[model samples]
Target chain A: MKTRYTYGGDEHIYVEIDDEMSLDAFFIALSLSNMVREANIPGVTEILPANASFEVRFDPDVIAPDAMMEKIKAFEHQAEAQEKRLDTRIIEIPVYYEDPWTHETLMRFRERHQDPTGSDLDYAARINGYETVADFIEAHHSQPWFVSMVGFVSGLPFLYQLVERDKQLEVPKYLRPRTDTPKLTVGYGGCFSCIYSVRGAGGYQMFGITPMPIYDPEQKISYLKDFMAFFKPGDIVKWKPIDRAEYDRITQAVEDGTYTPRIAEVAFDLDAFNDDMTGFNAKLMEALNDA
Target chain B: MTLEIIKPGLATTIQDLGRPGYFHLGIPEGGAMDRLAFRAANLLVGNDEGAAGLEAVFMGPEIKFGAEMSVAVTGAEMPMFLDGEPRETWTSFTVKPGQVLSFGFLKTGARIYIAISGGIDTPPALGSRSTYPIGALGGFEGRAIAAGDVIPVGDGSVVAEGRVVPDALRRRPGSPAELRVLTGLYWHRLTEKSQKAFFEDDWVVAPEADRMGYRFRGGQPMEFVDRPQPFGAGSDPSNIVDGCYSYGSIQVPGGLEPIVLHRDAVSGGGYFTLGAVISADMDLIGQLQPNTPVKFKRVEMDEALAARAERKTMISEIRQSLS
Candidate 1:
């Protein structure tokens, strides 16, 4: 892949890994960003990984813009040459589909949706050729998703399905954004799925709600003791469909400070996954299920 | 020392140099919009350049001093009063306990800065006292100031009085301000005509402008080169696969109005960015009021860095003069 590096003023360098979105492109972005982070270049302040590109914010005084550009080019070349094996965690996120909270919120803002009369899930399912909402949910959870980016809001992960583009779900954003989306609302837009980390304005088609919080500003959760955000750029998330009773139980655990997200350590071989997705996914699922 | 808010004007909040290094988490680097003015106000009162100060927009707040202390009002040319007696701006003056500070009218600029001898001592969130209100993070109670709220002051005060910022150093906000920009990222996506119009057209700052971004109008609707919308990218021609947005980057949402991302903008999004305002000109954008006409001038990287260095030198000179 040819990396196109552009200057974002003198302070930032935006590197486009590819023109289109692909798991391979995201993997390259993830790998390059991690390498950049490990380099600890003096002026580099922040490393932001996105869907098909990454950006580095730096102080021009400490490191010249040209010097930083050269450093990035070198890192990109090195990252491409190396064997792409990433040490990542597969997290099980319990989601209650057709939950009452998001369902009520979605109904209230029906005018903002693409299909005003039907529910967000129904609209998404019909367009994707799924027979029912339940079938759509099954298809959504059939494969694990790679967190391509963590942005838009704190801890909000933009998840791309691990499957091929043909199998990936796509939905249009709302005609107008809704002013009120409940926190932890699972939303779908374009070819990405996300959980609203905070309760605020959102434009994505709402489908379900996750009982567990992805963001805790107070750092109350043990896992978030060091950082308030839960998801990283390359983290994999598997959404497990749960019932109302399980949702309530998890919600209770979270409030009681006993909820620790189910996470499994897994070595993701990008090359192997690209070759045989079924075998790779089966092994990945076993690793997660064993945990 | 302490100050009580007698009348909380239009969107008054505590701000400093802002919190950086957390953009990956989607946290905005919220801070004083007019950083040059913010630093000037602090220097006048003999405080650190990064000291927290009160930022007032459009209207100024009426604050009552709880103790005798020195204060300087900077940025917008608002007619300030100390206990009903008119006071000059851009200079430090002492205020007695029970003396109420107020403003008459906004003469120029959009935002004003109020720096006391001791800085506003709000607890830092993510290493800065600046406020990010949308996320309800930082500043006093995670929002703008309100009447009857008392703000705590730090004891980082130095005995300084009558410090005045030179008129040359002070920025005079005007219409059709030319802002220098480095055009890149997705600059090639726009048509030749649209790209030319982006620079040639005089864009006015819309009323919807705020800390997150400044939306501009009056430019010809931008047209992009025809291409199949990439997967994961939105259907709009202007939309690209969600990418990292640099602070000061300009994005045209529907290829209509352009929004210049600012200090409190979301770190990354799907919008197609064409250019970014150079670091030195960010303060100029900060001073822009509603209806302020702006023209973006594309500059090279060398010119942008030279401007940044010049601004740094100017700040140092201001600090030296005040000290």
Candidate 2:
């Protein structure tokens, strides 16, 4: 039996299991334990893969470092005694990488790679695995995607692990910087995937655009509104792409207020005013006028 | 007791200690830029530290008191008069009913703190009395102080005389000062020369500086990270994650001159923050005037924490003296 090692730091803690198979189990067990108050989890803070290890963070005041490490060690011991199949789900996100911007990016990436035998293109194909970008778009019409971090710009989520190709993608710096990237714009930083929220200047290679309004302040019940953020660390993500027409339907659903993306059950209260307010309204109006 | 605004200052808003937590919802914790001065003013007038006080910028408004009350003024050296008589600040004084208390232009800081015997009576939003100018939430009707606006105080009653003012606060400091900083989440990404220039160069606050942020000139241009980057969460690989950051988180998009984020800043961004001005020095930032010269002095985490702890102890003692 191999032992797991977990170390705690000021902001986050490091968790290491004996093997890859134990990753999900370790996360679930730690989450189930009553060792920490879940609310203190830092914004967009979670356990994520770091090469071969996993790192996670929480408020040090809430969950003492030493105790969290012990919990991980205990979970490893339990797993060794009674091994079980890891409960992992596969979610598919339909990707259409056929836009002119995408093609230009791929070409740029190939040039940067400079593979003599066209192996870079082949490597890209292998990671994508579909015959063509159009086929990849067509294969997953009804597949679902997992959520990562929300609250970017305004409720933007950084989702991923789409293909996890062995070939590490190299992303170059922005040639020139502009000031804004609107919401639902798809961008690629080498192999890592990113989705932008609102228009803001960025440096990553942008691939496509989605006009869907993922964040709406008017909806009282939803924090991220049309874009439901439910995936935590260690969740499985299998992407199945849809054709342009189906993509339009999903976006329209978001626009028309009929769409509900997959989400986890988390307590969300909008009326949690913890302090006193005396003259906020008039002050806000005055500020706007002055600005 | 209430005060009717005769002339609204350049900008004025009611602010409390601030709204903590709820950053996951993408709300920046907005409050008084100079929290120490704000709290001190509140305590001098028999008000709680969390009471709503007016943050007056550049100049203060001419206010007509409806009834007799106790008031305290703090933050910078701004001229004041009570019914045409010169009013000394840093002292808790009485105001007669129907008397007009007016403030002259600031000779030092950009904002001044005003506290009444009782707290202001604005509605709380997301656990705060401070105003977020962008979202139009908190403070007086979720807006700034304007002409003809009337702000209500709690109880409309008078309490016993409060403690004597602290010496450190009695003399308002001058503008063009050196600001302390802690290396930010992406300080290492900046080149060595840039880092040196950032700390050594004297930067001037631009007139464009506002509650949302302070724009500075004269510092060497910031260079973007050589690698591709994402927005917000992708940018802050630290615990902050996604959402607006604390005031003083200096962001330089694509290596531009650093813009110090301030109260009422937007909820989220993709820019790189080389450093954040600690809470202790933010009030100093608020006091800075346009074209004022300033320098950044780097401090370690231990030193910053120690300074904060000392401030906490001092504030509590000051509170004790009043009670």
Candidate 3:
């Protein structure tokens, strides 16, 4: 269930397991690691697991790297002893793709997409069909997906990949061509799913709509319902769909406090600087000086 | 005490140290453009170095004090007066109740700082009193000071005795200043010719500069690896991963001109940075006005730290001498 490895004298540990465990477990583990205590050892900043490798960063002045490596190895051995110990839950989110602005935008997008060959298209195209796009979205409503980053922009939750697509969509560049890009824009660039935080000009292509606002200003919290987004580097993500009414109901529940939002955090090894890179300290110092 | 603004001048506002640790929430680290002058002006009075001080751009405000208060003015060499009497520059002075403090146009720097012993009284927003016009948050309802705005001053304590910084200690006004910088995120993506030009050529601070960022001319646009990452306003990886915002970030886009980020810039960006103006040189950058030619100087981290330490010591010594 658990494994540990050493990379360049530092501890890189990971846990091997089935995919059903909740992401909250990982969030808690990272938060605890940030407290910097391991078998009475102190000064650790983070223990981050990305791409199946967990890295621990600590103040080298207080603790030796090798000692931490030993602790990680011991911890992994203990984790290996436990199996099927954590409970996992699957959550489904319903998304509605009905908004006047979205409808108008979809029309324009379909027109642009059909540019090369002059083929008359209608909104009734099924799934990938220009026409059935909305219907396909509604049919897949209340589908459960994995959570990536919570409150990415105020309240927008970036979901993990929707693995069901037979073909992967082409992603755009990470950076939009310009600033002042408008809202309700959908762009695929990185490995994860991303939504705009607010209305501004953006390069993301227009996609379907979700009526619920990701961020709730008054509560100062985002309601990222059942989606766990807890996948480690190698974990699998399955995305399912739900209907329009279900989307409205879930959003209403979130807005009305019937649904609780979970907090998801990621930890990375800040101390593990890329020594090969020049001016590394300069960049760190820049942040420090400002601090 | 209070001061009735005769004219708000061009984009005047009260600023302090800034709102830190809120970048995660998409808040800009809004503060004074020239922190040195901001702190210096505060030190001239009895206020702590970070006390809220008036940031006056060229052509400062005309004001009448409602009560006798000790105030110190620094930054731009704008001819200042109280009751029409010529006042010394870079020093503290007493303005009698009902006396008017007016300033002529700045001849050198882009901004002038005016600090009151009591400091300006304004409600803090998002952990700071700095104004962010884009979000309409902080200082004076998140807006620039207007002609009719009455600024409140804190309760008085010690009187401010005028003390002039010696010619040897003061940075010579109008002297050409060099800005030291370090390479940033996308420094490698630039063309070899463009990169060489960046280090060798001189750039002029453009008129479009503000607290948010400074626009510079004369350097060819820096290139990035084929595509930029997610960038946006406010704190979100969507923006960062999306390549929307990059701090201390620079961007050339399609233009020959490059924009260097400053204090009030958004927390994230997606630009190819040739280099960022080092923290120590921020004050110098703040002092530059439109048309001011500046040469970029590269420095080691040690040199930057040393310069920063020296600046801190010099300011402290000056404060001690005055006290």
True contacts kept of each: 0.68, 0.08, 0.03
Return the TM-score for each candidate structure: 0.92, 0.62, 0.63
Give the better candidate number (2 or 3) by DockQ.
2
Q: Where is model 3 more than 4 Å wrong at Cα?
A: A1-291, B167-177, B223-247, B254-256
If the candidates were sorted by their lDDT against the true structure, best first, what order would they fall in? Answer: 1, 2, 3
lDDT of 1 by residue, A1-291 (tens): 667999988899999999778877887887898899999999999899898899999999999999999999888777776676788989999999999988999999997666788999999899999999999999998899988898877768999888977998987676555668999999987788998898876768888999998887778876788878899877888899999999999999988889888888988888899899888888877887778
Candidate 3 Cα deviation (angstroms), residue B40: 0.8
Over 4 Å off, model 1: A98-123, A172-181, A201-203, A242-249, A287-291
lDDT digits (tens) for residues A55-164 of candidate 3: 35444435554565566555543443333222232332223344445445444434233221321112222223434554544433322233433322332334433223
Candidate 1, position B19, lDDT: 92
Candidate 2 Cα misplacement greater than 4 A, ranges: A1-147, A152-291, B160-164, B170-175, B223-247, B264-268, B320-323
Sort the predicted structures by TM-score, highest score first.
Answer: 1, 3, 2
Worst 10 residues of 3 chain A by lDDT: A9-18
Whole-model lDDT values for every prediction: 0.87, 0.55, 0.52
Q: Judging by DockQ against the true structure, name the best candidate.
A: 1
Candidate 3 per-residue lDDT over residues B201-265, each given as its tens digit:
87888877877677788765544344333221111122223222333446553335677667776
- Top lDDT prediction, candidate number: 1
Q: How badly does each model clash, as a count of residue pairs?
A: 0, 49, 48
TM-score of chain B for predicted candidate 3 = 0.90
lDDT, model 1: 0.87
